[model samples]
Target: MSSTLAGAFGIAALFVAVLALVFAVQALRAQSGTAKAVTELAATPEPQQQAQAQAQPEAKPGTVKSELRRLSRELEEARTELRETLQHLAVVRYDAYGEMSGRLSWSMALLDDNGDGVVLTSINSRNDARSYAKEVKAFESDAKLSPEEEEAIDTLRKEASPTLGNPDHQ
Candidate 1:
């Protein structure tokens, strides 16, 4: 009986040892997993995460508001650079007297903000009222106009409507 009791105790100790070893192994694996997660997090860049955060939402419709604000800044820059309206060219064609052959008149207006531009025009029928327009965009008083005319016209924008008034549209 004494020998049998001694054997049972030894078996229990062996079982306990195995259980302890398993527990230790599990603990090591858990620790390693935690360490791996920490290392990966540290490897990431703060600025990249921030940039991605800004970039992802910038594509959304909600960010359209923000985009409009940015557009306003760009539009302001373009307007500031407009010197002479002729630096940009706009043409208007319409019937001068409302009837006669193919057409009546062609008028081209070039202008910047503050409604400063000229109209070079021809009318088939004589009229007292000439073509009129509003200031669409203006150049600063001191800025020199560039000889490249296309860039000047490209900067002129149509006036904004209520629905189209979103700065991004301009």
Candidate 2:
């Protein structure tokens, strides 16, 4: 009976050892799979970088320098175009006539970086309304500017001054 009990205990110990070995093997395989996935991710490029790489093929050193120069030129051209656009603007509203109280009359100045654009004025009176447009060059107009029109242009210039804290307005 003692020998039989010893034999049963040995079989139970063997079964537990086999179960532990199986679990260890499974854990090692899982760790190896995780390592392989991390390696694959490291080898892949970011989406934006991949797009840029695809758009521009590998080039010689000289070709790469020339591409950079071309890009710089395009950027400068875009900046020049933006400066030429009418981006600076101001409006002055006042009562054109003494009897008028609502201040419906307005003078608007629309200029670019170089102060080349137009000034538009609308005069409202009790009896009638009149509108006019005059071309502006270098913040001056060929036609005589009304006081309100000059005030509008002056407002834009004052706002664009470096002292006012906006150098981009220039």
Candidate 3:
């Protein structure tokens, strides 16, 4: 009876040892397989992500145009600010020779805040220094302006803004 019990206990220990060895081998194989997979991935060639990004589609013409328009608007605002910083502009309009004597002067000068603008025809010969203001907001319209007036306005426009590639940039 003692011999039988000892034999049974030995067989159980052997079985447990064999099972533990099998499990250890399986664990080692799993770890090795993971390492090999990582190595293979590292060895493969891959295109540069930046180069792939550059290969993407360019902006469409309409998108480009809209962007250009936005940039143009910003530039125009900058130019306006620069001009305001440097100089001023105005418009003047009045009758040159008034036949009516002693009439109230009807002269006006459209001017910037700094009072820089062209002097128009004298409203009245009676008053030499008196000047009025003109509305310059009508520059945008479908109607045509007087040739001389338009020319003067164009001259002011040319002088008011900076050139795109001006000497200042250089």
**TM-scores, each model vs. reference:** 0.28, 0.55, 0.25
When 1 and 3 are scored with TM-score, the better candidate is: 1
Q: How many clashes show up in model 1?
A: 6
Please write out the lDDT profile of model 2 over residues 7-51, one tens digit for every residue. Answer: 999999999999999999998987786567455434656475446
- Residues 26-135 of candidate 1: C-alpha lDDT, one tens digit per residue: 98987786567456434657466446546655534544344443554466677555432245455555666765545555655466444455445555665354433323
When 2 and 3 are scored with TM-score, the better candidate is 2
> Would you give me the overall lDDT of model 3?
0.48
Worst 10 residues of 3 by lDDT: 133-142
Could you tell me how far off, in angstroms, the CA of residue 27 lies in candidate 2 after the best superposition? 32
**Positional deviation of 22 in candidate 2, in angstroms?**
32
RMSD to native for every prediction?
21.6, 16.5, 24.3
| Candidate 1, residue 32: lDDT | 82
How many pairs collide in each candidate, listed in order? 6, 0, 2
Which pairs of residues have clashing backbones in candidate 3?
A: 91-110, 108-132
Give candidate 2 regions above 4 Å deviation: 1-70, 163-170
The candidate maximizing TM-score is 2
Worst 10 residues of 1 by lDDT: 160-169
